[model samples]
Target: MEQKLKLWFTEHQTEDYGITFRVNHVYESEQTEFQRLEMVETDEFGTMLLLDGMVMTTDRDEFVYHEMVAHVPLFTHPNPKSVLVVGGGDGGVIREVLKHPSVEKAVLVEIDGKVIEYSKKYLPNIAGGLDDARVEVIVGDGFMHIAEAVNEYDVIMVDSTEPVGPAVNLFTKGFYSGISKALKEDGIFVAQSDNPWFTPELIRDVQRDVKEIFPITKLYIANVPTYPSGLWTFTIGSKKHDPLAVAPERFHEIETKYYTPELHTAAFALPKFVKDLTI
Candidate 1:
């Protein structure tokens, strides 16, 4: 007799609700100094990365998140030469950031070396840009890096997890203040602000904090199926440029599956309910 067993991985997004995926195989499962890291093969998502029992990135829909997070601000800035990416160990944001010809140097500061090490092995397509000559990977505390750097980056991207564990400080007002000092006078920065459905307060609080620091601040949305609520929000804070007012000439041809020239402004068109959170 031959018997088959089905394995499933469930991310308990909240105490009451969560999402589950049918697992075909488990590639890597271990606890690093920071968090629990797991790489699993799923029928729907190809390969899935989980940190602390939450979806981080997947093979199928990563482009949507990575592209929106990178392009929205890159296009907003007139000429971003040096950029800093804090907490995106998967290298997905870095991959998208390099698409712009204006970016000459991209530094990635991630706290966990394990996330970077295993992502390269299990998620090559997403992590490919980490090895590029323009990228300098630093396996250290991103919070401290921002505290030390002064007027260093033309653009900064905070591709971090939800406000938990190591990422808690990233969402604080003090960090936003540090980011203001870390950026060039006219630098632009964007951060994944989690979904408005589960964390409306987070969205509201981020908006309020960022608005105090940057003259131009906006909220944008993207649909990433594997993420919580299937709806994700990113908060952009800029000293000079405005993402919505990007000129037509600023947009150039780029290879992307999700982000487009038209969608750059369109993504900021939030639903009524989601828009309420930003106010």
Candidate 2:
């Protein structure tokens, strides 16, 4: 009798702990100019995209992060005609932004062209919106894009990965100030702050810095199993609009799996430990 061996993939979140996955196959593995990229098939999460050994997205739970990042700010602002998406080459966030009829143009700036190229081929459903008439894909630096623009965007979503490698500068105070300069008077911007359990200081620093630039700053949470911690946080900074005070009429029918009008406020209700980071 012969025994079959199982193949597994593990992401070390910390020195002591990590999450492991059962990989059925590796579809693509290559070294891009910016980072190491890999797309693998898994039984639990379907197709998974990894950058520098970190899980970027998976077929199973992408909607949660994309919807929460896009819809919350879009609905908060009275009108979001121009949207800037920083680092979301996977195109999930752009797909959600286009759902709002008011969005006339959506620009995506990703430093890595390989992420955009391979994602479109491997994760078609998630990356489908990049080819839409209203979208302009730029293979450039998001930080530089924000620095160059002046009062251009109505909504800006920083759909970046963890604050490391190419994304390290994206998490700095100067970048948030640059975002403030890039946005229109009533513009709203959201950035994914790392998980509270693992990186509470990062969230606290982001909240502190964004609060100084934008009058309305809030924190929200979402559940993403493949990420470092099951719980993830997003920091939102608005020049004038308050996400918590979105009007009932502003909420419109949109195709979504995890985000809803009711859950909009609920997502902001953070656990005590997580809420402590905001102050």
Q: Could you tell me every candidate's TM-score relative to the true structure? A: 0.98, 0.98
Query: Model-by-model lDDT, in order?
Result: 0.95, 0.95
Deviation in angstroms for 222 in model 1? 0.4
> For residues 45-107, what per-residue lDDT tens digits would candidate 1 score against the true structure?
999899999999999999999999999999999999999999999999999999998899999
RMSD in angstroms, all models?
1.2, 1.5
Span of ten consecutive residues with least summed lDDT in model 2: 1-10
Q: Total backbone clashes of model 2?
A: 0
| TM-score, candidate number 2 | 0.98
**How many Å off is the CA of 161 in candidate 2?**
1.0
